[model samples]
Every structure is written in structure tokens, then in C-alpha cells.
Target: MSKTSTPGQIRRLTKAHKMSFAAVATIGAAALAATLVPAGTADAGTTVAAAPVAWTQAVEGVQAKTVQHLSMQSKLATDAAKLEAAVKAKAAAAAAKAKADAEAAAKAKKDREAKAAASRSTVRKPVYANNLDGWIKESLAIMKAHKIPGTYNGLYKNIMRESSGNPRAINNWDINAQNGVPSKGLLQVIKPTFLAYHVPGTPLDQYHPVANIVAAANYAADRYGSIDNVNSAY
Candidate 1:
């Protein structure tokens, strides 16, 4: 004979299966919660996922302004570098010009000095011995009467060498010639030298020959080393 299935037995078995299914669903829910939430935090006070904040036209405009500002700063920096390079180039050119000018001036000064030195070395002093022979003889006689040192021959040699015995000898052409300041007589006597060295009661005319020769000899003996070297070519 076939056995009949009972509803109470079947209902008991279904209830046990339902409990096992509920236990499995609870475990899966716990694993998913752990993956979503931070450790040590209760789900009752947990943060919910928020939606991203929307951007406005004003915000986008700020970003565009920042990009423009960076571009402007880059251009300004490049301009500053160019300006500095130009300034450096200008300074270098100015320095080079100054150096060249200084060198040119120095060369010109040196050349002028050299030319002057050469001129001084080659020029000769004036000589006038040929015309004053008679005047010299008379002057020598007067020097003897006064008892001045040295023979007539020695005096003649000295005077000839000194001024070439020229009565009107003048070394300075520029002043004496222009002003007509006569260096009169065989001794080349200026007015001052004549007054200072004049023989007493002698005529002030330096051309008197006798007076001038004595005065010249006195001046030469006093100022120069001697009549000997005065006659020699310097």
C-alpha cells in the first residue's frame, strides 16, 4: 500500500529551510556593509554618498582669467630680458668708444712732444762776430785801464764766443723786436744790465763800446761759471 504525505510534517520542514535562508541573507548583507563603510563606525550615523557640485559660468570665467594672467606674466618676463640685453649692448659700445678716444688723444700728445724735442735739438743760436772788431779793441783798452783780470786776447776770444762780440745782439726775437727794446752795444746790454753794471760817469749809451764791454764781462763773470764756457757751443 502507498503512504500519504502529511501537511504538518511538510510545514515543519519548510520552516527550518526558511530559517537557514534568512541566516545566509543576513551574512551577505554584513559583508556588503563592511565594504562600503569605514571600520569602527556605526552604520546608523554613517555619511551618505553626495552628488558632485555643479560648476557655474562665474567659476569657469575665473579659470579663464587665471590662464590669461599666467600668459601676461610670461610675456612681461620675456620683454624684461630683451630690455636688459639692449642696455648691456649700449654700455659696451659706449665703453669701447671712450677707450678709442683716449688712445687717440694720447697718441696725438706724444707726437707733439716728439716734434718739439727734435726742433730744439737742431736749431743754432745766433752768431755776430764779423762786424765788431774795432769796438772790441777799444773796449779791451778801457778794461786794461780799469785793471780788470785777463789779457785783451782772452777777452776778445770770450766775447766773440759769448755774443760773437755783437754790439746789438738780441736772443729774444719775439719780445725785443716787437717792443724795440734795444740790447745795445758790443756787450748786448739791456737797459737794466747797463744801469747795474755801468762804469761811474760813463755815458748811458750802451753803444759807447768801452762801457758795454766792461759791463758784459762783469755780468758773465758774476752769473756764468766763466767766459770760457759761455763762448762754447751748448
Candidate 2:
């Protein structure tokens, strides 16, 4: 309602008042002067001051800008939180997989070592004493492996009768010795019989107790069903 206001100036001021404070800069200084003074009245004794913005419009504009800024901040915070959660989940999954893989490798190595130990135990030879009982027991075990049937009592009885449990016993006056092959060892098995019926793991020497007993047992089982059946000069 300024007395110097032109219709165009009034329109621009009206538009500026409806907008924010920044919108006032769009109108030129001529429009501002026209709004403050009457047309062609510049020489009159009147004070020139800046235009006052409407308080309600200015407050409303500030409130709307504040709401927009808060909304943008909220959206950015939500996005950042989601990204952080995803990164943590990925890292946790990788750690779990690494732990599982390490455990599996450790278990696999333990199993391999166990299997190798078992194999070595299986392949290692059993030790036996150098006595009548040990030789008989070991020979019986060998006979069982070769499907040759005999008993501890039967082997002991035969060994006692043949060589009195002497591992180095040899019959020089026997028919076998006359033919240039002496009956030797605990069961008095000749060289031909000893070589032919010798179990693979025992020594080839007829003086070896277990070897001699195993050879004699093998021969006896083949000929008389078992060494247990041999009671006399077999």
C-alpha cells in the first residue's frame, strides 16, 4: 500500500513476499525503489530503506527447509547403517568359513596320521622268544595263517618226541642222513621237506626253531590232515 508503488513493482514485491528471502534478489533495484517511493518522486524528502519481509511467510519457509534437511539426514543415516551391517555380516561369514576350513584340515591330517600308524602296526613283525613254547606258539600262528591245522599240544608232543625240543637237533644216522639229507631241527624235517614246506616269513635255516616247526606242521597237515594227528615217527 505504498503511495509510490507501481503496479509492476507491486506485483514483483507480492511475488517476492510469497517466496523465501533469496527470492527478493531476483527483482531489480528499480522495482525496489518503485515499491518504496512514488514514480518520478526521487527528489522528494523521503527515507529509503530495505523492504521488510512478512514474518509468517519467512518462518514458514525456514520451517519447510528444516524439515527437508532433517529428512535428508535421516535417509543418509539409514543408508550408512545398512551398509555397515552388510559389511559386518560378510566379514563374519568369511571368518566362520575360515574356522570351519581350518578345523576340517586339522581333522583330515589327524585321520591320515592315524591311518599311517595303523598300517605300520599291521606291517611290523611280531617278536617271539627263542624257546620251545615260543617256537610252538609262533609256528601255530603261522600254520593258522596258511590254513594249516595244528594245536599247541600236538606241536609240543611232536617236538618233544622228534628232537627233545632242541632247535639244532640233527639225526646223522637216520635213513635221511644216509641219503645225504639229515633230518634236522625240532620236528626233524629233512632239507627237501623243509625247503618245500617253509612258510614265507620264517628263516630258511632248518636250525631255526619256528621255521623248522612251521615247515614240519605244513608237511604233517598236508599228509595226515593235521600235525595233531601225528603221534609217532611222522
Candidate 3:
């Protein structure tokens, strides 16, 4: 005949994980109070050294296995998180360095272009003052371009003797003046000679210092070879 199962068997089943220990233990006590088993049957093989020992050992084994599984999972999760953080940190550092390098190259290019622009933008044309000295120098520069030969001293001496550095000086008693076109300007040239020999690019006005001097010098160069050779009136 079949009999109701005892607490010993339930404990053994709970230890082996066949069923939940909480559910089996709760119903085991009630079954024990209400059911009948032979007197010797319930505690007959129920010594502490019997199935209880095996049950305790089996439960401890399951707890050890559970703890091992949880520990392994925790370690794997921690390692993965650390590896991800390290990869992100390394990538961030590389990006920062690349940005710095790009900025430095851009600044260097700008500085080079600025320096080159400064070098290329320098003005080289000569600036002249508005005076007799400046005029003489200006005329000489113009003369050199036309290959005319004359010196500063040669021109200055003739100017002082002829008109005393006056641009509006006129001779009313001279033969050239008696004809109606008076000798005028720093070198005292009449209208006919001024117009004939006035250097190109200079003004046509006779009283203009550079025009008068340049015209007189041209006339002198034609007759005497150069103004520098004509120390006296030409």
C-alpha cells in the first residue's frame, strides 16, 4: 500500500532543488499533523547522520555554485565598463591633440601670410620736398631718365648769376626783352627758347623753377655739350 510522504523525504527534495524549499517546508508540517504513518517509519532512518547530512551538504553545494556564478558576472561587468571608459579616454585625448595641431598650423599659415604681405606692401617711390633744393634734385632725377648730363653745382652757379634764384625775374633792358619776350626764371630763358627746349613731363610755364632750369640746361647741352662744361653764360 502507498503512504503519505514524510518530512524526511520533503527535506531531501528541497535540498536537491526539485521544488521550492519555502513551499515544501510550509506544507510539510501540516501534512505531518494530519497524516498517519507507522510509528517506526517517520523517525526510523531519520538520524542526524542519515539523509539530513546529505541534504545539508547538497544545499551548501548549491549556495557555493550560486555565489561563484554571481561573482563571475560581477567581475565581467566591471571589466567591460573599465575597458569602455579607457577606450573613450584614449579617443578623447587623440581628438584634443588633433585640434591643437590644426589650430597651430592655421596660426602659422596666417603669420606667414601676414609677414609676406608686409614685405610686399612696402612703398618705394621717392618723396620730394617743395623747394629749390627739392626741385633741383627732382629735375636731376628726371634728367637722368632722359640721359641729360648736369650736376647740382653746375646748375646752382648758373642760376645764381643769371636770376639770383628768382623764378619771376625779368630783364626789360636786354635785347631779348626789347623784342617783347623778356628773359625770365632762374636761368633767364626767353619764351622761344623755353618752349623749344622745355623738358617733357615738366610744366610749360617759364617762371616754374624746374621747367626754366631744365630748358636752359637743354639749350646749353646742345651748344656746349653739357651744363657742367659751361661755367660762364652760354
- Those runs of model 3 whose alpha carbons end farther than 4 Å from true positions after fitting are 1-123
The better-scoring model by TM-score among 2 and 3 is: 2
**Quick one: ranking by lDDT, best first?**
2, 3, 1
TM per candidate comes to 0.34, 0.54, 0.49
Best-to-worst ranking by TM-score: 2, 3, 1
**Candidate 2: pairs in clash:** 4-37, 4-38
Q: How far is 179's C-alpha from truth in model 3 (Å)?
A: 1.0
Residues 1-234 of candidate 1 have per-residue lDDT tens digits of: 898779998999899999999999999877665665556665676665422234456678889999999999999999999999999999999999999999999999999999999888885634434445655565555555665444466567756654676656665563554576656665566767777877664567776666777777666656663333355422
Which has the greatest lDDT? 2
Q: What range of 10 consecutive residues in model 2 has the weakest lDDT sum?
A: 47-56
Report lDDT per candidate: 0.68, 0.88, 0.84
Off by over 4 Å in 2: 1-97, 100-127
Error of 1 at 156 (Å): 2.6
lDDT of 2 at 221: 86
